[model samples]
Target: MPRIKDLRAYLDALAELGDVRTVDRLVDPHLEVGAIIRRSYETCAPAPLFTNIKGTAPGYRLLGAPGALSSAPGKPLARIALSLGLSADSTAREIIDALAAARTREQIQPVLVDTAPCKQNILLGDEATLDRFPTPLLHEGDGGAYVNTWGTIVARTPDGSFTNWSIARIMMIDGKHMTGLVLHPQHIAQVWQQWADLGEPMPFALVQGGEPALPFISGMPLPNGVEEGGYLGALLGEPLELVQCETVDLQVPASAEIVIEGHLSVERSGVEGPMGEFSGYQPHETSMQPVYTIEAITHRDDPIWPTVVEGEPVDEFHTATGLTLAAEALTQLRAAGLPITTAWEPFEGASHVLVVSVAADWRTALPGVSTGELTQRVNDVIVALRFENLVPRIFVLDDDVDASNVGELMWALATRVHPTGRRIVRTGVILPLLACYTPEQRHTATGDKVTYDALLPAAGKGREPRSSFRFLFPAEVQQQVLENWPN
Candidate 1:
């Protein structure tokens, strides 16, 4: 099948799979939209397409829980799989493997186009106002209506050596201004620092409702200096078409539904956050973040805005970021010469825990390496890659257990991991978003990460046969049972 070209195409595909709910009745953008999206994620329901949002112009629609987990039977990851151009029934392992495999392919640079659907209607200077669209207040205690939750914020270095497309929460300060949580170490902030050093405002293009894969790739933790557009092209097996922004020099997806052009202030000037984060926490404290001054706005006819309610598990942050992080981990571990077959970040873990599956033949490949030695090597590799912060807890299991399946991972942890000497804690940098950290640790960004070696005993010395249906039953009996399952 041809890859989905835009958000509309993705919605159509989702509708066909019974994964989209069109909310035609009037809905409030304040907390109603957020509550609905949150409910959808919690219940694994369909994506909500709000067609009649209160206080917004007619046809100015919003898509909530765009990348949230789907309720489709046997395809909980359907939304994520569909975003990657995979079948709705694709497994979690398939999605991760595809993302990781794309990293090995030749990067296909994006092709520039003169015009785009995003430029269908253009508003310049004071004419460009945020009130034209429905900016949803995604949480009850959110600072304001967030306008860029699921959008791609395009930024570049002052010298133009690196162009980064990332997703950061941007709240609407007014009709012409916004602010967000852009912090150090993130590529957006890194680029902003370069612009600050040059004494210039950082130009940004916030593109919303682009091709389905745009947000997925934008939210990824790709290596520094790697442009997301090219990586996206590589992932889709075709060059993504781009169009230059009206006010900024940055280029955006040609098929984008809406594009907001602006410049980030050289200095912090606005209070932002106190919004619910991916870790399902809503700290009452807010911080001063850089202000974004809007210069131009462009959108397709009856444009659709996409927003992700970030709190709790199984949301876009968990689905998209979790998969991408696992893919990155798999790639990094394999490149480091570890006998890793696959890796996964379960949604239940909320992108904090990484479960890595060791190759079944690791013992043969490593001669007589002890389990502890293997665990230490894996931990060292993770620390070396500086992924300790992103992955706070890690579980290492053998290939017999599918790491992507949370149930299997838990089973491995319960049955294989020793009561003592299996869990190792190492000091590392930690993000404050994690709820596990204490106030002091959150303030200092320093903490200990735990790694659990859940691998089975070496050479099957003390390993017992798994009593699961897949392993316990004879092949013929299993097939017969499956054939007669409906009976």
Candidate 2:
């Protein structure tokens, strides 16, 4: 992996690895650029750099599918690996292992610099025009071109000790202002509510492009009051250089391509949503979301706007956020002393599905444990106890199978999980995106969850040893087979 010091360095590295494609064709932000990027993500193609975008300045380029997976052989997880400072040859297990290791290592503080390339051009007040940049309208039915796709929002609590970094979509309402949807359940929205309750607008700074690690950290499932900057610094083995926003007190990455300084109005809200979400489905209704007043815009000479083409599985958002969430879940479960061996985010279904593989010893210890009992226990431990929302299904597998491999998991489910005996279902509100249950089943306070025990029983009464070939093979034969096979 190339050493990524800033956003520009990361872009250069992508280009060098043949993972970035620069297109000179003029594409419309209304949908053309977004459509192309979405297709690229589905095909696992290179990132599309739209240099000539309709209704935008010449130099302003939009980077689509920035962190989408790569098609290159031996580099399936390349996009995430690059973002996390890993080699393109890194595997999914390696990526998760590295992150888990970094979490335990010493924290690296950010190096503060007086001036950065992002400040090369500063637009404030009337001069700061969001329309000048090429913001892509991701979906055909989207309300407008969203400028906040894959962008990081930095906001500090009133007391200043707790800082939050998160990703939220922002639509350009006008030249100097925009409207952002802050879901009631999200931390950012909750913080906005707190400020609104106190009759104060929440100060915020939206960063377009910075170190890829910044966005990765923003999407992390860390505990409350944990600073994303500190997490990012620790992951990168260096401190992130930050600069104060022109209008807001919040500090942003000094090397960010574009920074929008603004505040969320407590007393005001406008119709927000109808934008395609990570679930690959559009919301049926638009709600009154918080309004953002953009006070300033700062950028480098030629900024590259990173974006995610949100739709279905295999999109940039799914691959990026899914891997991050899986790694986080594993780390959290281990930290909590859970007897989990592996965790995975299956790409076929929505991001809400998490498959956890555990040691057979742990599964056998809880004998006669019904599916409902196991589901309730696991759900309580993962969601109710950890407070990590959005997970609806937890499929537990034996240690022999890899949770990341859907095929192996499906095989286990087919042979081991009996519908009448092992299938578990707990109905309640868990994930809003789950199409299986109706709205009535969703519970805001404590949602319902299910766990499927896809493991074979060790022993059965009045039954022969269920085919030893299915469970184990001779160690000498396995070694011989592996040795005889050609690379």
Candidate 3:
């Protein structure tokens, strides 16, 4: 396994693995190039590199669908594995297991360097120009070009002890200005709001493409005040090197491909929306978001622009966010002393739904209980609902069911759950993204939800033994049957 320290190194690794394919033919960045990449993501094809983007320098390039999919066999988790310091052959179970293990390790702090390759060339004050870069106008109806896609925005709390790295879309507003959507509940937005309340501009740095683990950690829903850089260091098994920004009082990865130093005005607001999101739908309203004044721009000689074309499930954004959320959920549940067996955010759900399989011992622990009791207990264990703006719909299952496999989970729900007897609906705490729920009902307040108890009936009450002889088949016979089946 190769350890990549920066975007250029990682791109080299991807090319070596035959995961990246370059198209030398001239392509337009306006809409043509984005459409091609969108089609590639839809088909789970190789990462496409547009080397000859219209109106851009020859060396300037765009890496579309970088974390989209893997062409390897029996390795659907390849992209995530690479991002998390695992081999390409790693399985989904292995990826989850690795993350769980890392969570238990000691934290490693990142090292700061005085100079780095990211500062090979710097544009300051009036020289900084956002239009010089090949920021893609991704969707047809998008309001403006988005400059930061797979980038990480670094911000610190008022006390400066808590540093946060997160992924949020940024749109180019002018030659030296941009607007970013910092959702109210997200850490970035929270930090900005604190500065806004104090009547101070929030200094920030946007780093585009560094170590894969860096961006991966940025999107993770870790506990508030957890240092993302330290988490990345732990994941990489080496301390990441950082350098101070030219204008902002912030530090960014020394090996980052491009660094944009800016400040968010506390009193300013600008139009932000109308771009197609990961849900494959655009919201009807265009709202005012925070405005950022770019102070400087720095990058290597030739930088590779990495972006996620957000729309529909199974896209790059969905996969990256899903893996991080699932891992974070598992960590949170275990920390709360819950015996969570498995957890998965189905790509089709787009982070709106979470499926959890818990240990069967819960049924015995709470005896003489009706199906509703199990549903309430299961709901109590879920931690995402407690998050202000991320209340996801959850489906609880027995240890035997695989949360990642929708078909298996559905089969269990159909055979074991009685429609009227096992379903429990609590319509009080839902996320706004769920189209099924009305906008007014999906606010941050507690909303309603439903839990379908699909666990097998307890050992008594006229029901057959949950663990029967037929259910425990010989392992060798099962293996033989699978081996004999034709593809």
Of the pair 1 and 3, which is ahead by lDDT? 1
- Cα-based lDDT for every prediction: 0.87, 0.74, 0.74
Please give the TM-score that candidate 3 achieves against the real structure: 0.91
- What TM-score fits each model? 0.97, 0.90, 0.91
Residue-level lDDT of model 1, residues 176-236, one tens digit each, is 9999988766789899998888889999999999889988888788887778989888989
Predicted structure 2: lDDT: 0.74
Stretches of candidate 1 off by over 4 Å are 483-487
Better of 2 and 3 by TM-score: 3
Residue 218, candidate 1: Cα error in Å is 0.9
Pairs of residues clashing in candidate 3: 426-448, 426-449, 427-447, 427-448, 428-446, 428-447, 428-448, 429-447, 429-448
Candidate 3 lDDT score at position 421: 61
- How well does model 1 score by local distance difference test? 0.87
Q: Which stretches of candidate 2 lie over 4 Å from their true place?
A: 1-3, 360-377, 385-387, 420-431, 439-447, 459-487
Q: Report the C-alpha displacement of residue 234, candidate 1, in angstroms.
A: 1.0
- Span of 10 residues, lowest total lDDT, candidate 3: 383-392
Q: In model 3, which regions exceed 4 Å deviation?
A: 360-374, 383-388, 413-431, 442-447, 459-473, 482-487
Name the candidate that leads on TM-score: 1
Top-scoring candidate (lDDT): 1
